[model samples]
Target: MADSFSQAARAATNELRQLFEPTPLQRNDHLSAQYGAEIWLKREDLTPVRSYKLRGAFTAMAAVLAQRSDQKVFVCASAGNHAQGVAFACRHFGVTGVIFMPVTTPEQKIAKTRIFGGDNIEIRLVGDYFDDTLAASQGYCAEAGGHFLAPFDDADVILGQASVGVEILDQLGKEPDIVILPVGGGGLSAGLTRLFRETGAASSFRYVEPFGGASLTAALAHGAPETLESVDSFVDGAAVARIGALPFETLKNVAMEHVILSKEDSLCATMIDMLNVEGIVLEPAGALAINALEQIKDQVKGKTVICVTSGGNFDFERLPEVKERAQRFLGRKKYFILRLPQRPGALRDFLGLLGPHDDIARFEYLKKSARNFGSVLIGIETTSPDAFEALFSRLDNAGFVYRDITNDDTVAQFII
Candidate 1:
């Protein structure tokens, strides 16, 4: 069964060459040295759509058109990468497509989708949330009798995604020691795992998902796909609330210990590291696999590892926020709410307490809680994480009262 599936996946991949050539699989010395392993990156980020999503979208659309030449319309709902994939496929096939996206999606993404689809697709700005957008798209597809292209759950889509595994084997010329995959709804991970297993590959696998969106972890624990109570949208590309039903069918046997949940803030640091040290720009979801490496560094030592750099559709507009999150995670930056005496030279005294390497990024006087004291919110950035210890010591010695609010999500959201 696995052999037959691998053959089908290979055929699908051969067909995909008409759309775009295989994305590069390159060895990375930077990560290799950092982790004491031979690290190779399957650069899906280099795809025409800057993601592996294009492979699945194109494969599913082509399979439908091949079986039913009369099928002239397709529909899908996506806020980012998938939308672009479908749009690109629609244009290539000369089929009419309707894509529904959340109203809050960035304009940059919307424009890119429009460009990819050209006149072959129509864009619908729907509800503020993804679930609402997906419902609207499905309803419209049913009414119009157009084929709805699922982003990951469909069999054809999964088969399309299996091509990634095929390429990894072909490009590397051998099975790797371990394959680290970043999981969203599990199309990519499931497809690759199935293909590799069927082909008799000896490669082990590690799955990575955002800590705030550990749908796979939840599903494995519940013995089925389970919807998360809440999801953090920070890693927009991989922040899925539930794993796809079809994908989970293939991945259900995966051991819990093999799955690694990456903190969203730590992922930001990975993104920054990749950008600064390796000159690779990765969105939060794209950085998931690389981020998981730190957690398993001991195991990967002296081993041949493949980390799929999933996507590179990062918006430069989010760079500042990414840097701030990265700094906080690295302990080189912090936020504090200070109660200071509302007397002359008090501000100067507080400023004197800061070390030479410390810089105030933000300072705001909230309000006077008492006649003699005022509440102040301050954000400090320092050259080293250790600088905070000395700065805090000085505050203690000066009789200052302060509350660290850097990790206080509720307080930081409102004020920071």
Candidate 2:
């Protein structure tokens, strides 16, 4: 069965070539040197919709349409790359598509979906969360007698996503020693792992998921698909609450130890690194596999490894937040609450503690009621992590009372 599926996936990949060339499988020199390994990145970020979602969308639609000639209307629930993929495919096939996205989804993604689908797609902003939006889309599909397209989970969608694995092996002419996959709904990871196994490839697999939305980990722990209570939407593309049932069927036997979790903030650092060093813009989900490389550096040393950069639909508006998060993760930035003596020269005295390279990014007095001292919120950024040590040493030597709030998510959420 797996062999048959692999053959079908290969055919799907061939058909997909007419839609867009295989995404580049380029060697990343910077990462290779850093990890002491041959690090290659499968550039799914360079896909026509800036993601590999289109592969699954197109392949699933085509597979379904191949069997039934009368189905033309398709509906899907996605606020990110999947919507764009379905929209683009809808336009390509000249079919009507209805996309349901969360009300809180960024306007940029909505606009891109519109651009990809053109007149072939109609997007409707529905619920505040994906679950609600999904329910609404399914309800509409049932009511209108339209075909419902799942983002993942379905066998056809999984087969479509298998094209990524097919492309990787074809482009590299051989499988790498290790394949790191970013898991959301499990479509891509399941597809890749199944294809590789069926083809007798001996590559080790590492699954990475956002720490805040580790549905795959949770499912592994429970031995079944499980819904998370809450998910941080920062890594919107891979932030799935529950692993898809069908995808899980293929991924069920993956050892739990091979799955890695990446902090959302730390993931931003990898995004910054790729953008600054390689000029590669990656969405939070796209950076997951690369960000997780640090966790298994020993295993991959002196070996050939591949990281699938899933998507790059990054909005420049989030650049500032990404940089700030990256700096915090690297210890190049700090935020603190300072209790300053309410005196004429207090501000100047506090300023003297900063090193030459340190610069204040934020400073706001939180409380003015204390006649003896004032509570101050200050954020400092520096070029090197050493600057923070010097700045803190100076503050300690000067006997300044302060509380570092940089790592306090509760307080930083509002102030930082």
Candidate 3:
């Protein structure tokens, strides 16, 4: 079975080569030095659609076209990379594709998908959420007699994704000591695990998921794929509410200890570090494995580690948000609701309480016409983590009433 899966992976990869060259597997000297490990990055973000989604898209679409010569239409639902992948594949195969995207999807993504598909695909902005868009697409697929290409659930898609593992082994010319993969629907993790298992490669696996959407962790705990009550969509590429049933079959054996849940805000710091230090623009999902390195620093020391950098379809518009999140996670920034007395020197007193390196980023008075006091929302950025301690101490010493909403997600959600 391993041999056959290996062959299938190779064949699928070979077929894909006709469309575009394989994504590079580059060694990172900086990460290697930092972790005391030989770190390699499987640069799947460099794909034609800027994601690994294309491999699955092509493999699934090709199988459908081969099996049913009469089927000329394909349908899929995605807010980003997956949609672009299907679009590119549809154009490559000269087939018509209808892509359904959530109305809330960024315009940059929708435009890129359109550009990739050109005349071969039509896009529909239907629902506000992915589930709604998926339902609409499936309904259309059924009504129009078009083939539906699942983003990660299908067997063919998993097989296609396995090719990444094959490429890694071939490129590195040796088995990596550790393979760190970011999990979304479990397709990539499932495919890679199967490939390694079949090939008998001795690389241990570490799965990383954004803490808000730890579908893989939930599944492993429940012994089956379970739907999450809510998923933070910040890590859009790997933020699935549920793991795919087909993918979970292979991933069922994954040890909970091997799974790493990355905090959404901390992941932003990793992104910033990569961008500033490595000049890599990683979307939140793409930063997962790298961010997990923070939690497992001791385990990977002096080992050969491979981090699969997934998707790079990030909007520059979100850079400020990412920066803010990163700063807060690093303790270099804080937000608070200060109750300021309605007096002339109150603002000056609060300003005087700030340390030398502290900078005011946001100052919004919630109530202008209060009788005696006003609720002031404030955001402060400091030079170092310890700077927050000094500033907070000063605030307390000065007897100014303030509520730190820095770690308060509920309060931060509304004001920050």
The superposed Cα distance between candidate 1 and the true structure at residue 84, in angstroms, equals: 0.6
Q: Which stretches of candidate 2 lie over 4 Å from their true place?
A: 1-3
Clashes of each: 0, 0, 0
Q: Relative to the unseen true structure, what is the Cα RMSD of model 1?
A: 1.2
What ranges in model 1 sit over 4 Å off? 1-3
Most lDDT-accurate candidate: 1
Per-residue CA lDDT of model 1 for 1-416, tens digit only, reads 35488999999999999988888899999999999999999998988889999999999999899999999999999999999999999999999999999999999999999999999999999999999999999999999999999988999999999999999999999989999999999999999999999999999999999999999999999999999999999999999999999999999999999999999999999999999998998988899999999999999999999999999999999999999999999999999999999999999999999999999999998996678999999999998988999999999999999999999999999999
Model 2, residue 141: distance off in Å is 0.2
Top candidate on TM-score is: 1
TM-score of each: 0.98, 0.98, 0.97
- The Cα local distance difference test for each model comes to 0.95, 0.93, 0.92
Local distance difference test, candidate 1: 0.95
For candidate 3, lDDT tens digit of each residue in 1-416? 34487788899999999888878999999999999999999998899888999999999988888888778999999998889999999999999999999999889998999999999999999998888999999999999999999999998899899989989999999999999999999989999999999889999999999999999999999999999999999999999999999999999988899999999999999999999998998899988988988799999999999999998888999999999999999999999899999989999988888888999999998999998999999988988999888888888888889899999988888878
Ranking by lDDT: 1, 2, 3
Per-model C-alpha RMSD: 1.2, 1.3, 1.4
